[model samples]
Target: MAKFQSLKEAVAENLRDGDTVAFEGFTHLIPHAAAHEAIRQGIKDLTLIRMTPDIIYDQMIGMGLAKKVVFSYAGNPGVGLLRRMRDAIENGWPRAIETEEHSHAAMANAYEAGAAGLPCAIFRGYRGAGLREVNPNIRSVTCPFTGEELAAVPAHRPDVAFIHAQKANRRGDVLIEGIVGVQKEAVLASKRSVVTVEEIVDDFDDLHPNLCILPHWTVTSIVEVPGGAHPSYTHGYYDRDNAAYLEWDRVSADRDLFTAWMKENVLDAGPEIFAARVKEL
Candidate 1:
């Protein structure tokens, strides 16, 4: 069994330059805060893989912490284009591998294929769509059984999968409420997996059995840190700071402002210090 003394140690020890890392979360829930800390600590040349990346990916790419990014969508909720990510792609800042998905189901379908140890997965529902034209990486394959061409997305198996859960035990048994679709696939497809939880339980039995998403045996490391998902929120703990996200979206448009923000919030602050700052916010 792998043991981690703390969240910081786990992030520092496991994350390295040039590794392909996946973050498990939706629009704004249970982000890989510890992994972001690793990025802030000068872990460079990382290839970030995700279904839909938001501010986290934008921040990393803007700060030059990532070398490449593989994802479907990236932007703020209502603020048009993601400033940093758009600028990066427009100016050819970092190596970008873009993919497109018309809906949540399509993205989930791709991850399902990845988890199932298949080279690709096909869906005939979204045929001759704009998403297919935009993403050249996704190929169209003819179905062997039906002889129909459908969109086939290649498998994505990352080097590491990082996730933040609502609760877990010392042994890394995770419990997350609601959807567990892509998270489950990402964890299964990765070579190494790390989980950070808002609260730690003494035993797996402490959590309702149905709510448990990941077992201890599947997780390589477990870290306990309350309020770990700052910009992102744990389900029942707190709500997302919409004002802060808006502020981030506005300021991050300028490169200088983005750099300054990262230095102040991420680079200069450790886990404890960062949590303290969030409390002030």
Candidate 2:
């Protein structure tokens, strides 16, 4: 069951060095605060997983926290390249990080397969793609019935999954509104899950039955963190911080600037600052 805890406590208990963790949210509700907390705690050698790895992964990778990154797309979102990630791959700055790339379809299916307790996810992808040449995980399986070859990738069963949501009730059921991604499957597929929410309400009254709600049984811990997804918008809570995304392109470009930025903004700051940032938005 989900126990209410601070972001610091949740990260300390559920995440650790050399663990495979998925911090998922898609375009919105990205768990920036939780990732920041992990950075502040100086967790290292993490195998980070995400469908779309943006600035947060860039920060983690830049800080030499990630030993490997498993993902579909890697970038700064609306901005240009993830300079830090590129630097790590190209120059081995901070550290050399291994990368496993996949397509959007493959990643989504892999997460789903993991949630279903499957060993691998088979989908019709990478037909003419170059990922198969480099990624050993990309292989083909012949269908037993039809003899059709399908792409197969190992399921993403992470040590823990982290996500940000709009709200959670007293029961600890998390509500994720707007642009849902593989967060649900990521949570269900993980050994443990941490959720940060904008607020904790008594109940979700008149909510649609089909809405995305991770039952308390599926969640291990919940942190009440308003603006936990800052820089990434939370539905009905705040807008995406476009300026931050723009500024990251500058901060992450130079090694000295990146280190200084992390020292001042992340190393020196705490999770409490995120709530204050949301007030300004």
Candidate 3:
């Protein structure tokens, strides 16, 4: 099979309307920038799955790109301002599915099960919690082996998984530091995976073997974009634009203003435009 030549192309090729996509990143690290690019390119009706929804998710939701969202929390890049999400819920615009905060771990477990080709996985944590009441997707069932109550998280086979990495090869080998957690599971469970990297190294052996999170074999496309994770740092490469995040929080209270800002900064422009805009901030 021909490998993807660019991150933008990879996202455009893999993502479709109404497809379930798992975005990897937390707060402002290793975000799905390329996925947002794809959305700007006119992909719509996306069902975004993530542990937390930030500015990117909010932008997409506000632009009417997202049809559904499964996440623990939805807010500004960092602070709490879910203007678009609140609008959708209050007006009943789209299908808004709210999951428990633990739903992040549950979805991760489900992705692991899907990657392992198992029907489901049973784990014990936060039983009868407030999250359970909000997230109807999760089910409590009797453990087949132990006859004890357990949370049987179903497999989460997403249509695509989009993540950003510190480094990668042309073949799509990704290198990231610290705990991967749900990101690894998302890559495993998704049928197609696309990643944006700060730089494409010549060889995977250039870094410590253990630092390699997603191997080339699992990735379908590798796009090399310097400073791809702008605003959202890439650990060791740059620090997050905390001031920018703060501004996002301040302006996100107004959906119109937030949408206009996003269109001017993220949607109407590409990485180059965003880079310049960020520098001005």
Candidate 4:
């Protein structure tokens, strides 16, 4: 069952060094606050997983928390390159990190396979993509029935998964009402899971049929963190903090500026700060 806890306690108890972790969200409901909590707690050597890695991952990498990043596309959204990610990969600023790149389809399939308790994900992809050459994990399998070739990759089973959602009811069930990404599959595929939400409501009284809900049994902990996804909007709560995303391009370009910004804004900040950030955004 999901225990309501502080972000600090949840990360401290459930996450560990050298664990494979996935902080998943698409353009919406990204768990920026939970990621910051992990950073604040000084978690290290994590094998981070995501689909399209953005600013939050960049910050984590710059802080030297991640040893490996498994992802498909990596950028700062509408902005330019993720400078911190590039610095680590190219200049090895904090530390040298490893990467396992894949296509979007492959990653989605891998997560689904992991959620289904399968060993690997088989799909038709990498036909013309160069990801196979860069990643040895991309292998080919023969279809038993048709004798056709197919692509295969290892299942993405993480030790822990972090996500942000719109709400969790008193029963601890999470409701995601926005643009749903691979958050559901990522949580189901993990050994443990943590969720940060906008509010804990009495019930999901007027939820639409298309919204996704994870039963309490599936989550390890839930942290009530408003604006948990700042810069990445939650469906019903707020708009995307576009200026922050744009400013990241400049702040992240300079090492000293990046460190100072993190120390003041993220490292020293807490849940109340996160709530205020939402209001300001």
TM-score of each: 0.88, 0.98, 0.88, 0.98
- Candidate 3: where is the Cα deviation over 4 Å? 1-4, 93-102, 274-281
Per-model lDDT:
0.72, 0.94, 0.70, 0.93
Error of 3 at 250 (Å): 2.2
Model 1 has a clash total of 0
Candidate 4, poorest ten consecutive residues by summed lDDT: 272-281
Clashes of each: 0, 0, 0, 0
Selected candidate, larger lDDT, 1 vs 3: 1
Candidate 2 wrong stretches, greater than 4 Å:
none
lDDT of 2 by residue, 7-27 (tens): 989999999999999999998
Best by lDDT: 2
Residue pairs of candidate 4 with colliding backbone atoms: none
- Give the least accurate 10-residue stretch of model 2, judged by summed lDDT: 272-281
Clashing pairs in 1: none
The superposed Cα distance between candidate 2 and the true structure at residue 115, in angstroms, equals: 0.7
Model 1, span 1-281: residue lDDT tens:
54655867777777888898888687545564675677667788888877777888787777777777777667676555778888777875544533334445556776677778887767765565677677665677877888988777777678888887787776666778855637878877777888877778777765566784777777788887777777766677766666767887778888888878878777777667535534644
Error of 4 at 185 (Å): 0.2
What's the CA error at residue 178 for candidate 2, in Å?
0.6
